[model samples]
Target chain A: MERVTVILGERSYPITIEAGLFNDPASFLPLQSGDKALIVTNSTIAPLYLDTVVKSLEKLGVNVDSVALPDGEQYKTLSVMDTVFSRLLENNHGRDTTLIALGGGVIGDLTGFSAASYQRGVRFIQVPTTLLSQVDSSVGGKTAVNHPLGKNMIGAFYQPASVVIDLNCLKTLPKRELSSGLAEVIKYGIILDADLFDWLEDNIDALMSLDEKAMGYCIRRCCEIKASVVAADEHENGVRALLNLGHTFGHAIEAEMGYGNWLHGEAVAAGMVMAAETARLLGSFEQTDVERIKRLLVRANLPVHGPESMKPEAYIPHMLRDKKTLAGKLRLVLPTAIGQSEVKGGVAHDVVLSAIGCCLI
Target chain B: MERVTVILGERSYPITIEAGLFNDPASFLPLQSGDKALIVTNSTIAPLYLDTVVKSLEKLGVNVDSVALPDGEQYKTLSVMDTVFSRLLENNHGRDTTLIALGGGVIGDLTGFSAASYQRGVRFIQVPTTLLSQVDSSVGGKTAVNHPLGKNMIGAFYQPASVVIDLNCLKTLPKRELSSGLAEVIKYGIILDADLFDWLEDNIDALMSLDEKAMGYCIRRCCEIKASVVAADEHENGVRALLNLGHTFGHAIEAEMGYGNWLHGEAVAAGMVMAAETARLLGSFEQTDVERIKRLLVRANLPVHGPESMKPEAYIPHMLRDKKTLAGKLRLVLPTAIGQSEVKGGVAHDVVLSAIGCCLI
Candidate 1:
C-alpha cells in the first residue's frame, strides 16, 4: 500500500492506494471499531463491489448500510443529496455515523457534500474507483454538485476523513472513462510539475496500457502535488487557484454542451489547449509548448480543441460567472512553460475572445 | 454602534448591534467600494427593508441585486437555494460578490448556505432583521436549509464576513416573534451565565416592551456567550455541544410539529423545560429550578411544555435521530442547575419516556 497525507492541520487525512484495498476494510476506511457506516455508491458500482465493501466493514465489527444512487454526472444534484439524506434518516443514521463514498468523482463529491451539510457535518471517507477522482477530485477536498447554470457550482471545500484508491476497481472502468481521467493527470503535469510532464511524455503508452507501476506512480504524484497545494490553501484564496488550470474554459464548455454531454475531463482537455493559446497570445507561453500540450492530449486520446458549437460569445458569459472571476474580471490560469502556470486576472476581453476563437475546431 | 467579535481565527467576524445600521452600508457591510452584493431576503422582508438595503449598497457604489424568496421556514429548502443560484447566475454574480442575508433565521440560514455552496462559496454578510436571528443564528455561523425529514438536516458551518443586527427592526416584529427571540436570550443565561438569567428576569418586562438598552444588552450577551463557545469549538466537537442546550429536544419538536408551525424559540422554550424535567428526574436538577425556568418562559410568553400530540414514542424516534446523539445514545443536554447544563449520553430510555410524559400538557 502507498499513502499520501494531505496536511490540513487537524482536518488532515490520508490517501491510501493499493490494487485490492477495497476488499480490505482495515486498510480501506478510517472508521473506528464498532462504528456505523453508510456506504454511498451508484447502481453501477453497487452490483460490482458493494457487497465486498459491506462484508469487509461488517467483518471489522462496524455496522454497515448502503444507498445506491443512479449513476451519471447528470444525477449529481441537490435532489440526489436529499435522497442520501432520506436513506440515512430512514435508517436512523446519526452524527456518529460514517459516510463512505464508494464510487468515482460524482459519488465522492455528492457524499462529501452530504457529509459536509448533513447535521452541519459528519465523518466521511472516499473510496474513489475512477482515475478522475483518485488523482484529483478525491484528493483536494473540492466536493460539490452541479447547478443547472454551471458544473460544480453548488458545493463546499469539505475534506474527507480518509481517501482509499483501489486501482483494482479501475479494472472495470470503461475505456472512455479511463481516458477521461488522464485529462486531470495531464493537468497536474502541465500546471505545476515539469518533471512529471516529461515523465508522462515518456510513459504515456505505459499509462494507457494500465501498467500497474506506472499508473500507481502517476496517481501518487498527482495526489502529492494536490496535497501540498491544498494544505497551503484549503479555501482557494491564492496559489490553490493554479490547480484550476483548465477549469474556467472547461466549465464553460461543459455548461454550454450541457452537463454529462461532454465529460468534465474531456472539456478540461480542450480547455487546457485554450488556456495555452491564451497564454501564447499574451507572450508568456511558447508556440512549441502549446503544440506539445496538444500532442500529449492527442496521444492520451483526449480532445485537443474546444467544441465547434461553443463560440467565443457563448464562452464569455460562463467564464465571467466562474468562481475564479474577481470583481467581474476573468481570472485565467495560463501556462508560462510546460511545467508552470500563473493566474492572470483582468485580462482584456478581446484577448479572451481571441483565445476562445483560437481553440475552436 | 456596539460590536462583539466572534474570535474564530481567520474566519472571525464582527456582530454589530445598533438601530438602523441596516441603512448604513458603510458600517454594516464589510464590502469594498464597487463590489457586487446580492441581497437575499424573503417576501415579508422585501416589502419591509429590501429597497432600503439595496439603496444603501447602491449608495456606496456597490452593484446590488435582489432575490426575494417566499417567507416562512418551510421555504428554507434546497429548491430555494436553487432559486438563489438562478438569480445570482442571471445577474452574473462572481466570486467577488458578497451575499447579504437580510431577513430572519430562515433567510439567514438559506442565504448563508447558498453562499457556502455557491460557486464552491462566495463571501456573504448577515443582516438579520429578526430578533431570533440577531441573537443566535446570525452570531454563530450555523447555516442550513431544512429537509422534509428534519430541521436543518442539510447545511454547512459557513461564517459571514460580518453580521449587522439593527435592533430597530424588532419594532416591526410581531409580539410573538419578539417572545421567540427571548427564548434564545433566556437560553444563554440558563446554559452559561446565571447572572444573565437573573438580569433577564429583572428586565423581562423591559425586553418585552422593546426597551432598546435592555434588548441591546440581552442580544450582546447572548452573542458574546455564543461567540466564545463557537470560537472554542467551531464544529461543535465539545463545549459547543453545550450551546445546544435545548436543541436536541427542540429539533425533534420542530421536526415532529412541522417546521414554522411552532416557531423555533417556542419549541425551544418547551424543550428546555423538558430538559430541566429530565435532569430533575436524573437527580441533577431541583424542582424549583425547573419551575424558575418555566416561570421565566411563561413571563416571556413562551411555551413551557411539549406538544400534547407528540407522545413519548413520537419524540423518541426523532430524538434518536438528533445530531446530538452519538453511537445511538441519546446525548441530552440536561440542566444540572438553573445556571448550568451537561450533555449526558446513555440516559435510560424509560427515564426519557417519563420526562416527556412529565412535560406533556
Candidate 2:
C-alpha cells in the first residue's frame, strides 16, 4: 500500500492506494472505535462491495448505515442528495457520524457532499470504486451535485478523511469505463509528468490488459501527483487550476452533449486531444509531443472526437462560459508539452473557434 | 462598529457589526476592487437593500451581478440554489467572484450554499437582514438548502469572507421578524450567557419596540457568544452542536410546518419553550427558570406554542429522525439554565414524547 497526504494542515487527510484497502478502511479511519458510520453507494456497487465494507467497519464494533441510490451519472443531482440526507435523517445520523463513500465518482462526490453538509460535515472516507474516480475525482476534495445550468455547479472542496483505493475493483469496471479512466490517467502525465507519460506509452498494452502490477503503478503515480498539487493548493485558487488542463474543454463537451451522455472520462479524453491540437496550433508544444498525447489516448481505446451536434460556435460559447473562465475571458489550460501546462487567458474567440474546428465530429 | 473574528486560525474571517456596513461591504470583502461580486437577495429584502449594496460595491469598481429569488423559507431548497447557480453561470462568475448574501437566514443560507457550491466555492460575504440571521445563522460557517425530507438537509460549512450585521436594517424589519429575531436572542441567554438572559428579562418590552440600544446590545452580545463557540468549533463537531439548543425540535417543526408557515424564529421560540420544559422535567433545570424563559418569549411576541394542525406524533417521529440525532440516539441540547448547556445522551423516548405532549394541541 502507498500512503500520501494532501497537506492541508489541519484539514489534511491521507489517500491509500493498494489492492485491498477497502476491506480494512477502519484500520486507517481517523476515529476511535464505536463511532457510527454511514456508507453511501449506488445500485451497481452496493450489491458487490457493501458487505465487505460493512464487515470491515464492523470489526471496530461501529454501527453502520448504508444508502444506495440509483446508479449512473444521471442520478447525480440535488434529488439524489435529498435521498442521502433522508437516509441519514431516518437513521438518526449526527454530527459525529462518519460517512463512507463506497462507489465511483458519483457516489464519492454525492456522499462526500452529504458528509460535508450533513450537520455541517462529519468525517468521511472515500472508498472510490471506479477507474475514473480513483484516478481523478476521488483524490481532490471537490464534492458536488450537478446543477441544472452546469455540471458540478454546486459543491465544496471538502477534503475526505481518507481515500481507500481498492484497485482490484477495477477488474469489474466495463471496458468503456476503463477507457474513460485512462483519460485522467493521461491527464496527470500530460500536465505534469513526462516520465509517466512515457511509462503509459511503454506499458499501454499491459495497462489495457489490466495487469495488476502495471495498473497499480499508474494509479499510485496518478494519486501521488494529485496529492502534491492538492497539498500545495487545496482550493484551486492557483496551481490547482493546472489540474484542469483538459477539464475546461472537457466540461464544455459534457455540457454540450448533456452530461452522462458522453461519459465524463470520454469527454475529457476527447477534450485532451483537442487541447493538444490547440497547443500545437498556438506553437506552445512540438507537434511530436501533441502526436504522442493523441497516440496515448488512441491506445487507451478512448474517443478522440467530439459530438457533431454542437458546432464550433456552440462550443466556443460553452467553453468560454465555464466557471473556470475569468472576467469573460477564456482561461484555457493548454499543454506546452507532455510535462508542462499554461493557463492562457484572453485567447481570441476566433482562436478557440478555430481550435474547435479541429475536432473530429 | 464592533468586529469579532471567528478565530478559526487560517479559516477565520471577521464579523463587522456596524449601522451601515452594507453601504461599503467592499472595504471588508476579500476581493480585488474590480473582481465580480454577485449579490443574492430575496424579493422581500431586494427592493430595500439590494440597490444600496450594489451601488456601494459598484462605486468601489467591483463588477456587480444581482439575483433576487422569492423571499421565504419555502424557497430555501435545491430548486432555489439552481436559480442562483444559473444566474452565476449566465454572468460568467468564476472562482474569483464573491457572492454577497443580503437578506435574512434563508437568503444567507441559500447564497452561502450557492457560493460554497459554485465552482466548489468562491468567496462570499454575509449581509444578514433578519435577526435570526444576524446573530445565529450568519455568524457560523453553516450554509445549506433544505430538503423536502428535512430542513438544512443539504449544505456545507463554507465560511464567508465577512459578515456585516447592520443594526440600521432592524428598524425596517416587520414586527413578526423582530419577534422572530428575539427567539435567537433568548437562545443565547439559555445556552451560554446568563447576562443575556437577564438583559432579555429586563428589556423584553424595550426590545419589542426595536429600541436601538436594547436591540444593538442583544445583537452584539449574541454574535459575540456565537462567534466564540464557532471559533472553537467551526463545523458543529462538538461545542457548535450545543448552539443547536432548540434547533433539533425547531427543525422538526419547520419541516412539519412546510417550512414557511411559521417563521423560523417563531418555530424556534416555541421549540425552545418545549426544550426548557423538557429540561425542567428531566431535572436539568428549575421550573422557575423555564417559566422565565417562556414568559420572556411570550412578551417578545414569539410563539411559545406549536401549531394545532400538527400532531404530537407527527413531530416526535420527525424529531427522532432529526439529523442531529445519531444512530437512533437523540442528542438534544437541553438548557440547564439561562447560561449553561449540556449535551446529554440516553434520554428516553418516553421523555421526548412527554416533551412533545406539552406542545400538543
User: Who wins the DockQ comparison?
Assistant: 1
Give lDDT tens digits, candidate 1, residues B17-114.
99888678686557867788888998888988888887788888888888888989999999889999989888888777889999999999999999
Instruction: Give stretches of model 1 more than 4 Å off.
Output: none
lDDT of 2 by residue, B1-361 (tens): 6777778777788887777777775544675677888888988888887788777777887898888898888899877788788888876787778898989999899899888878777889888988889899998788888877778877787888888888889889999988888888888888888987887788989888878777777788888899898878776668888888888778878888788888888888888877887888898899888788888888888777788787666777777766666656777889887799888776887777688778765
What pairs collide in candidate 1? none
Cα lDDT, model 2, residue A260: 82
TM-score versus the correct structure, for each prediction: 0.96, 0.92
User: For candidate 1, what is the DockQ-based docking class?
Assistant: medium
Each prediction's whole-model lDDT (CA)? 0.88, 0.82
lDDT of 2 at B207: 82
Model 2: how far residue A356 lies from native, Å: 3.3
